[model samples]
Target chain A: MLKDFVKNIGYDDPLEIYLSKLEKLLGSEYGISKRAVSLLLLQEDEEIFELVKKNEGDKIGVISAIIREANSHYSNPLSYIISERRQGEASRITNSVMSVKEKGLFNFKETLSRLMMNPFIGGPILLAVMYYGLYKFVGNFGAGVLVDFIEKRIFDAHINPFMVDLVNRYLPYELLRDLLAGQYGIITLGARYAFAIILPIVATFFFAFAIIEDTGYLPRLAMLIDQLFKKIGLSGRAVIPLVLGLGCSTMATMVTRTLPTKRERIIATLLLSLAIPCSAQMGVILALLQNKPLGLLIWLGVIIGVFLFVGYLASKIMPGELPSFYMEIPPLRLPQLSNILRKTGSRLKWYLFEVLPLFIFASVLIWLGQITGVFGFLVKALEHPVRWIGLPAQSSVAFLFGFFRRDYGAAGLYDLKTAGLLSGNQLVVACVTLTLFLPCVAQLLMNIKERGIGVGIIMSTFILFFSFSVGYFVNLVLILSGINL
Target chain B: MRKIAIVGSPNVGKSVIFNNLTGTYADVSNYPGTTVEVYRGKCKIGGEEFEVIDTPGMYSLLPISEEEKVGRSILLAESPCVILHVVDAKNLARMLMMTLQLLEAGMPVILVLNIFDEAEGLGIDIDLDKLAKELNIPAVKTVGTTGAGMDILRGKIEEHVKRFC
Candidate 1:
């Protein structure tokens, strides 16, 4: 009844003829009109190409010829030509139907938004925001005071002792009691790490991220970083996933699918798995380095250096066109408090559900390994790398925990640092190596899912060895220079 | 039952419009590229039930990313009774490329100039009647966040469904 009531694109005669020809050859029906499918094919849409090749076997040569003819007539790519023509028509319609009132009171949001995109201004503003939002809020308060209170006051003084005593009194079996509430018990290590150490860190991070995200500042950050990013073989578009990686790398790995090219996805996945530290690890690292300013600076320097060096090298090795970025920057707004709270709430729920089980599971695996002597061997294997990096052999446990989760390893470091086992040089080296370590197992699996098994395994292996080498090099440099930190 | 699918470029208020129309929360955020999944909800207009699918923001018919591919596939598969070609009102020229594509596909699309208030605040005024007449389809302006112009939109949806479905 409504056959072509609203006219489609006003295609020129040649294109219209080609569409009809392609329509007839399409043979089987796609859910959409063959006209649309033909347009997609002209644009060289890969999935549509596969669909057409499968559905319209012998007729493919003729369709390709038609597309080739169309391409010859246009200097621009067909996709560009098509969109440009559509835009021209849309402008014509919009010009006739819309008017500007010209009341143009300059909005403050507009000025602020422009300021945020200017590199000179935006860089300083970004630093300030990070210092206050992440350093002060998440690191100092969340990981420092909050974690100290929860891990020491709440758990150490009360919960762990209570649980241990309760288990000892109730369970006569020594192994069962140890499994339940021993030194590395599920109750003591796993739940404590989840609730006491990592929780406050990520809670504060998500809160800060929600507010930053809600204010629509990330795109501006992208614009500011575009110049720097290009040098690393990524365009500004890579900023979104990389910034989000600061929140959680597993989620960020999944988010990499939003990148325009498979090459971009691979580069992004590789970079994220290596240099980007998730929120929990970031906060904990920051808190650890807070007292040692020199150590913190060294760690920061090493990470940025590795990020640039490796990215530049990878871009050179990988064969792909340089990424061209076009992004929409939403108008900055005062973040709604209600919305921020809801975002934080939802993210916290997601984080807890994801990590809490792994925390407990890692605990069980460790306990089982200890009973079977596998844990000792694994730690022994890790001790060589730890010692090579100038860290104590006991720090090997932290490296072992790194396989489970980044933050779990950091929490282990927190324990070692509190026990005064690592020096200033050792602390800086440890933070650098761990920050560059392969992301958690979930992220590893996500990498395989997104980038396939070969790339995934290869990337992870590279990350593992590269991280230790960087640590060893840093340690060597510091020792040779006789640096205090 | 009839169906309406909301489609457009990212950061336009498609998800907000979908939420306001269907009263379903689908994570409306200021950032684009956040929604990597599709959302669907059942809505009722004019005493008849309808299914509304909220697609990921697609830039054009041509797919650049997985999200756009998913968005295009949803539109192709659902064959919704009405497609709301939601656009950022301020950038109507860039957004309407997809609208033209939908029209070319012979889909019943209603041009929704969303973020209407912000566009007006920027001194941009759109003539709904003239746009509707020019396009030969319903055109409505909506500030999806504030629920402004929702009633007229609902009316247009019902009219479109009654005529087509």
Candidate 2:
């Protein structure tokens, strides 16, 4: 058996003597070797120490004394001393077997990798990537082109009409027919949004995200952004979850578990919920603002301002140790097409399964509320705020849809746009408010699950008021300035 | 049936190797920290069934982040029959330290030099036999993406299981 001749990583003579002495006292029943337990004890691993204490009664004091003695022998911690010795042995073995052939010149990947992390060069590169990958590809092609084809040519022209006609002819009960295919029906609204609007947008976003992921560009981007993140009380490592939030905030909220500090996790979660609109909502917003470049820029400016301003305030409010950043910069490589497609396919499958049912469920709930007249009352209540923000009363319906899902609300706005209900100014304001609106039901559950219920509720409440307040202000500014946009 | 657990630093193709061995897919990406949870699948090796575990990436026995803690917990608690210490071939020296720690723990370890093609592209040549002897364990070269060297890896796993398990 391999354990018979376990490779003994040699430490200093005193440390080795201490290790053997500690090893003599440890219980033999541990899953790992006694020597490893002793080594972990010497390194002051609290969990291992507790485990040893639990098993080896009466020997705890002796182990503690020996660890202290070992500590006295070294200025550095025993963990560093042990790891350094292990590294030395590793280097020795690696040197004995590995050879590097020197190249002449022009290491293109190395050069490009450096450029990617360089502060002066990295910003523009990041912008260009966003412009092309997100704006041009996901926004224009996915939301604009693909969404138009699916929503207009397929769902609106073919499926919705056919389903409504079928329901009208076959179903005797008006309520049942309305639930199936009438206004705010499951097939007409929910299935249409899921299949026609969200599908293409999320699929394209995941494809672009997968390609970016496989190219090993994220770490470099992280390093470049670390300084800015530090100011916001997050390490460069937080970039992973924050970036993932763009695809889906629910998953990204779960991914925050990877962060080292609770402070960082909470901050990251708050930002994801409030500012980082998921791909589906973002796609709709981009499409809404596609013809108005100035409006798009203003929307971008306000959301970014809110992101930084809120982050800075949160950092100041929370008391914790500042996060330190460290991440591995894997070498840049060409992404394999097969792998990219597989990843995109799996992500799309996951997104659809997670979202499709919710969309349909939201429709059923809305239909129920309508039959009971509760939906009209809620929309009427919402109309007050909707009008205060200078939006038409019809916009209240979209605001109500916003609670089910951010993208659902945006999809409502899209319907409004197609109906020629909203003006340019109203469109931008609606987009901004919806983008900063409450996280969806799934993300809310995730927030409570990841962070405790208290923090999750508090965050949601703050976001609920802040979003509308910001909308009100944006609308006020637009009216006062008389920009008409 | 015995168990085979694969552990490594993030993005070293542990999931890829796990998929190859188990004939199932786990999320494999170039970026680190994707596999934040454990993945388990069944595999048949040399007429023997094995439970193969794909763990979150960890740097060393001493864990810092939450995922690393999960990785270490699986190793120290589950006690698999064969521990595949997967490492990136391009960064052998830095990664091999964890291999040494795994060995010191007296776990049954097989060093996997994954991403072997990329290392070769960078003009780094590894003497695999010497690496095996130097570490006093079987070492396998693998391109996890393409499943190269997988047969030899399976052979090595079968040999280890027959001898130890």
**Model 2 regions lying over 4 Å from their true place:** none
Cα displacement (angstroms), candidate 1, residue B130, comes to: 3.1
lDDT of 1 at B159: 88
List model 1 lDDT by residue over B1-165, tens digit each.
677898899989788898888986776678888777888898889998888899888888887788888888887776778889899999987787778788877788898998888887888888888888888989998888778999999999888877777
lDDT of 2 by residue, B1-165 (tens): 688999999889999999899987787777888898899999999998999999999999888887888888888788899999999999999999999888888889988999999999889999998998888889999999899999999999999888888
Candidate 1 local Cα displacement, residue A401, angstroms: 0.9
Candidate 2 per-residue lDDT, tens place, A181-294, comes to: 878888998899899988999999999999998999988888999999998888999998999899899989988988999899999999999999999999999988988999
Find the candidate with the highest TM-score and give its number.
Answer: 2
Q: DockQ of every model listed?
A: 0.64, 0.75
Clashing pairs for predicted structure model 2, backbone only: none
TM-score of chain B of each: 0.97, 0.98
Against the reference, the lDDT scores of all candidates come to 0.87, 0.91
Off by over 4 Å in 1: A1-6, A24-27, A44-46, A73-77, B1-4, B18-25, B40-52, B150-155
